[model samples]
Target: MIDRRHFLQSAAALGAAAFVPLALAQPYPSRPVRIIVPASPGTAVDITTRFVAEALSRSLKTPVVVDNRAGAGGLIGTDAVAKVAGDGYTLLFAGVPHLTTRWFTDNPVTFDPVKDFVPIARVSSSALGIVVKAESPHKTLGDLIAAMKRKPGEITFSSGGAGSTSHLCSVMLNDLTRTRARHIPYKGNGPAVTDVIAGQVDFTCQGAPSVVPMIKAGKLRGLAVTSAGRWGEIPDVPTTAQAGVADYLVASWIGALAPVSTPAPVVERLSEELVRIAQSPEFKAFCASQSMYVDIADRRQFLGQLPKEDAHWKRIAQLSKES
Candidate 1:
């Protein structure tokens, strides 16, 4: 006694209903998110990322964790993130090294830093401080330069690694002043700074967050900061320009990135959350405490600057080779 037409319509309606749940499935980040730090735990990038992750966890209302994959000067962790699915679940807490690593290395790099990743946000930037042991005879940046000139390769400087920003800073210093200094590479900036403290190395150029507290505690003497203006935390420290190195300006920036295949909506959401966090007063204060300043740049802005950064570092690498 079934009506044929009505029965057919009912079946069709049921078939369509079955797909509704699938279409209405959860949005991006329904599960925990992991941010990979491509350096040791105590590095400046790691410290800044922990702060961002905590704020992001609250903003997204999801658990955000930091995974350190330190080795090969940040290549391991960065390449790992580049290969993952772009589902918004995995991200990279990236820095200057992210752009400069490939240029500095002789081995084949698996991922293209610019093409393989999408920018999320840029959180903070800090000047590098040229520091030495408090007891060292070189009291100022000029003194250090003079010593390097006097002894050429005899005076030694330590860095996080050969291709690291710290190393590039020292290289730039030597090139600018027409001087020479022995280069010592360490696994991480913490150890490099420690060696300078232990008197094993003559000096080191490190980010403010890593060395500012030590400078305050009198463990390290900050000869000059590699910025146009002096760092607020170490107000007395002169800028490189003021210290007679007129063109030796450098700044280290930290930001977030995801695999390029990530959906536009997901990338937008992450960028919005990060921008919000960076603009918050609490975050600003936190960055200031570490001698960094909150530099909020969302996805578009961050992407726009990548090419310029790449060019700058490429030039730096050439300078290193020439020297």
Candidate 2:
């Protein structure tokens, strides 16, 4: 009984209603994004994340910010991101420490390290160097190993903390080389490396970026690099394999992650942008200035390798306890 005009108008209204959802569903990054660094500002993790955040802002045409949530050895900040909505707004700028945190902590962590997050991309990694005081008699890695063997648990090695990358590096070396060296835990990398320079500690397995300057200044001796290849900055120093400890390589790396259940499309977009940023010349230059190297991997590569790294660190942690 309705007139043609009235019937046509009602049909048009239903059509508009059907189109509303499609129009309202905007693409990702409709607003600002935040990359959370679970470490203090000025630390390596913070610096790396800030660089990526700036790059992402340019690529995504959105305002990307870095949020420093430093506390409780990065647990507080990491947990914050882990528990947030899977909306692609919050991300974690994490490195080796993040993977090792739960293994070392006594309290139960709130999220599953392997299941609670989606890998975006691996940013970069800094190689660990085997270093000793310039005046130390142990001139080579072999000499240091021999000393540790001769006096098991007598020679001391310093690390940033109990479960830091430095600590696990030393522990892994001990396990593979079948030597025993006492571990001395310090508050941070700066203090631990400082004591090594002061000859307070026998040696330390620390990141090359932090120790390269000391080596250049003749304050510390670079024996070997714990990387597959010789570090470019210290090309003369042999790799762990070349120095006789076969199959030894370790790097402190940073990667980006979104909360699990974040849409696959969102994850893909983030991964694409991150891969671009990591491969950019600007990022390489920044890494060189910081004594680090650029090692980028896409989402699939990162996700595939994460489980192996987790197992590797777990074994290192167990070795630490035995040592």
Candidate 3:
């Protein structure tokens, strides 16, 4: 009895209406997610990322894997994440180097560190330790500073490499104290700390995880930690300020980030899971064992700190150029 054209239109409308709910009900992360650690395996960043990935996999009910992309000071892995789709399937396990690598490298960076990424959550942060061989004559941080002043360019310091957190922390120390110590860049923190222990270099600033065990084992002496408060694991070591250096605080942090094009809902979901993982007792204990502390920040809070972090790194870069 009805017109044929009108009947066909009604049927099409009914079919379209039925499909919308099914599409909307589809869950995010239907497949495995991979977190790319822009550093070699066994590094602190890689270890932390792996821990987070495991927890995330359990929380999201999907596989979460860590892929190490170590090269060119983390530029390779970072750039790879920047170029990937924003479907939350791929993410970056990033740190301060994410912001400072471009400043230190002469090579052209393909992605904008600030503009190309979105902060999901901040996992943890730790202060670096200024260490020397246990048998070194520089007994304290002040003593080391005095020695640098006394010899100027003669006191050599080693670092993981140019633009590393260790390098930047030492650079900041030199700039703040107005001392000139020759920098010996190594291929990695292991070699740099090794040379310190070998007495080939005067001293080096390194993250706690890399140097704490050495300090405890009498292989290295902790002069000062670059934090406002003393690290719990090594309470005997004073902070930089307490050690008589002011305005010389530097802490390295690791966090999760995705491409800027990622949808807001996906970002929110990931952020929630990360924040939860970061706050759990198990995660806190794990961080403490590594001489790091849980520093959980949500999406908005994490994004808010990037500007200041970027500016701080920029200033460090300028100081490096001047020196």
Candidate 4:
């Protein structure tokens, strides 16, 4: 038989352990939570993250604030969040560039992305669009490639920012088509798009979230989707691969992550709310209106995808280093 003192001590410890989660669950949001967005105000990732923060605030009856820390190709902001304490109060709402099918050694990394954070939810995905001036000479992907072949580096392309989805996708486009298009990295997609419209840059590839409306208004001409398949919003447009640049596919995605070592229960609770918000009809309508798609990946699935993305970027970075 166990001694009375030992038995009592054991019982007390178990009781306290059980009560920790209960006490934490009692009141989740006693104050406002901060969400760190790794981009500027107008990009698709920032827009989507703001929407999620709104929904999260309403659902949790708490204040969810978005803090934009845009610079150094998203690395500056990402590192900020990674260094935060493992408290549920700080979250990083980021895109594919920060964490995706890429590797650090092959690409560029300011931090050890794989170890710094834990995945919570994969909230959404946005396809890229091939955009050119409304009065451009190239009417299709083939036309652009043919022209590029005629004069390497003569064709200039703009991107949202250096090392962004726009930049990576454009480089991938060149890699696939065996042509060269000089890169013009702007501070944000808006400026780049403006320059393209003014005929300063030859073309740009960015997420549909920003270009769809421009394409609709005839301010910009959309040539092809930078996705594997066609876009539902712009059915008439063909994929870059389908249009001639075979194997051309690129997209932007957003996810929510908390610091590693945060209590599993807290992470799971937040994740549950994310899933609920994602499935809401209002959220779906908002995404559709923006020409984006909602893709649900639970914690397990989301975490599993991180390494694959890291590897992909690592290879890209390495190649970039070589060239």
Q: On residues 28-90, what C-alpha lDDT tens digit does candidate 4 reach at each position?
A: 767889998878898888888889999999988999999999876677688888777777899
> Which pairs of residues collide in model 2?
none
lDDT of 1 by residue, 232-261 (tens): 898999999999988898888899999999
Per-residue alpha-carbon lDDT of candidate 3 for residues 1-323, written as tens digits (9 for 90 to 100): 99999999999999999999988668998899999999878778988999999999999999998999988889989999999999899999988989988887878899998889999999999889999999999999999999989998899999887888988898898898889898898877888999999999999999887899899999999999998888888899999999999878888999999999999999999999999999999999999888887998999999999989999999997887777
Candidate 4, position 77, lDDT: 80
| Candidate 2, 181-223: lDDT as tens digits | 9999886688899999998999999886578888988899999
lDDT of 1: 0.91
User: What is each predicted model's overall lDDT from 0 to 1?
Assistant: 0.91, 0.87, 0.91, 0.81
Ranking by lDDT: 3, 1, 2, 4
TM-score of each: 0.92, 0.88, 0.92, 0.86
Regions of candidate 1 where Cα sits further than 4 Å from its true position: 1-25
